[model samples]
Target: MAYKSLLTLASSAEGVAAAVDAAARVALASDAHLDALALGVDRSQIGYSYVGSGAVILQIAMERAEEEARLNGKALKDALAAQGPDLRFSLDSAVAQLGALTDLVSSRARYADLVVLPKPYGKGSGPEAEAVIEAAMFEGQAPVLVVPERGFAAGAAPRRVVLAWNQSREALVAARRALPFLKAAEQVVITIVDPPAHGPERSDPGGMLCQLLVRHGVKAEVAVLARTLPRISDVLARQCQDLDADLLVMGAYGHSRFREAILGGATRNMLESAQVPLFLAH
Candidate 1:
């Protein structure tokens, strides 16, 4: 399916502009609409808690949250307006009461073809910032494109892409989700590490995946990292750095709710820390 709308969640004007440029690249390539969403904190419902000492602290926090959100919104609006009428922009704020940040983002994801998140602010120790990132990762249904904290300059498009393939449904879905970007990329590399010893032997899954990409006319290559001294995540990160890859696409490995005992090894590792922006599908 073609990606027609790209949504970017921004907290700062610079971030908003960067997101717009990133989304616009894809939109320009595929003739899609670039939607820039400015995320702000909601303060209306912040003081609803009834616990001791909680009420007073909550009230003070609510005022501070509201002020920050308003400030961020104004900054973002001004920045986008300065860019003139070429970009489409929207302002949105969410009140973090009873841990509803995830629900708020998930609701927004339903309308977006893709979602972009800026890395957390401050020392990255803020609870709200952490919640926002987690919500985007686990609850947001659409493919989320993350921009680093330092941010990106305008027209900084992804040239090289790394696909973390593991021959799972999530991985396949992630690849498909990234088809638009992949088609526009200068280079695409499919990397897989620590293949299970018992999977199909005669039919090499990695080979088949590469063949499929070639069939689609994508400039693609395949590399299988021998599980050596380094851990799988480290291996993938090192390979990505070596390839100078700007983006990483991979399946989000996880188990079904019913099968608590079953889990994906690679997925767990990638979640701990990823060196590049990962396009993950579950």
Candidate 2:
């Protein structure tokens, strides 16, 4: 579980500085070589409303978008420097249509142990960013550390870690992948909310996970609580705050992704309102 290489996505779009900052800080903390990628999006796909305007206006709008995109790359580089020390890392940029850009990012991400992505990994972070996440996880077959837009502070390594456990394939994958962090953490908590009473977990919820961690030499505490709130993520957030957890490791989209997209499941809710760094794997 020791990460030797890390890839961070710095989109040449607006609102990506915080993710770069967090990635730089994380790169500085972990014993891993860092790859910083500056992704540029096609302006044509950005604003379709420009189609209704005259040719002159459309040309002007495209030029303006290109200029802003250029500025976005500069800002991302500045963000890496603003990490308070000269970061020793390699920087690269990719400029292509949305379809190609995702493939490009995924190709680069294949060499890295973890892909660092921006949180709210939905429409708000832009379509390109969303594509990057899906590509890295699903296509590249790598885990993603979803950083918040607010960014993590310097020295953001996990001291206290929280594992959102449920007896599902996705959850099991996340837990096993997160063993490194759990072993390094001073405190680890296996938090389960509203366990299903009719399954094998009817006897002991989260106990098997805690025991599995023990086999890996990681001592963890377990907490099984009711869904006091509407969303499971809300309950996990409260637990993270109480435990002062710096990192949260959990599975992403155990159910149908389309269902979660429409009905708003734990993965979507957590992505939208993440309070700390979330490590996710499919």
Candidate 3:
């Protein structure tokens, strides 16, 4: 199904316009409406451990956080207004005050068709931000399009799309969810990595995926990449770059949380070091 509403979460006013522009582009292409959610983070609540951790301290912290949220909200609203009158914008703030990062995202995932989240800034491990992304993938039920923090302009329609296929349930779901963008793309590539030793019959799901896309009226090509490299994320990133792909479509492959940490192999690697816009669905 085509996306009807796009919900993008913004933390700062810096990339707010770009985020809205990207959302508006998608809305225009899919005939959808763009809804923007600007998140205000209370830095004081950064290490807040419990609800009853000194009421006076908590109240002061929450107040500062709310003020920061308001400033961010006003900046975003003003930016959108400057862009033009055609774009529809909605402003709201949430107290990410309680629970883990995942809990916050899960709570917000209920309201939108899709979520657009910005990559965390700086070079340190973005475990918290990554948690937010993971929560959206597992709990949101809808697709999450992650925007890179630097380089590349936002709101540009993807001209080339790549599907990272492993023939898993999550991968198949991601493929199906990417149909709208895939159909509109000028070129589509289905990349399979480290296939089983047997063959296409019992080995290659990517071949089957390519066939499926053809049936769906997508002009797609299948290619296999050797996984000799240490990380699959590196391999996939290189493949996308070599193919000159603007967007990458991949299944959000991961086992249940208790079984493993930070999703699974591919999901973890890609989320941590994603180079292009990725459309992930579980």
- Predicted structure with the largest TM-score when compared to the true one: 2
Candidate 1 structure lDDT: 0.64
Clashing pairs in 2: none
lDDT by residue (8-80, candidate 3, tens digit) is 6655555455455566667666766666655555445435566666677767877865775676677667655
Q: List per-prediction Cα lDDT, in the order shown.
A: 0.64, 0.75, 0.70
By TM-score, the better pick of 1 and 2 is 2
State, as a TM-score between 0 and 1, how close model 1 is to the true structure: 0.78
Structural RMSD, model 2: 3.5
Candidate 2 lDDT score relative to the true structure:
0.75
Give model 3's TM-score versus the native structure. 0.84
- TM-scores for all candidates: the values are 0.78, 0.84, 0.84
Top-lDDT structure, candidate number: 2
Two-way TM-score contest, 2 vs 3, winner: 2
Runs in model 3 deviating more than 4 A are 12-17, 42-53, 100-104, 121-128, 150-156, 198-205, 256-264
The CA lDDT at 145 in model 3 is 81
RMSD of every prediction: 4.4, 3.5, 3.4
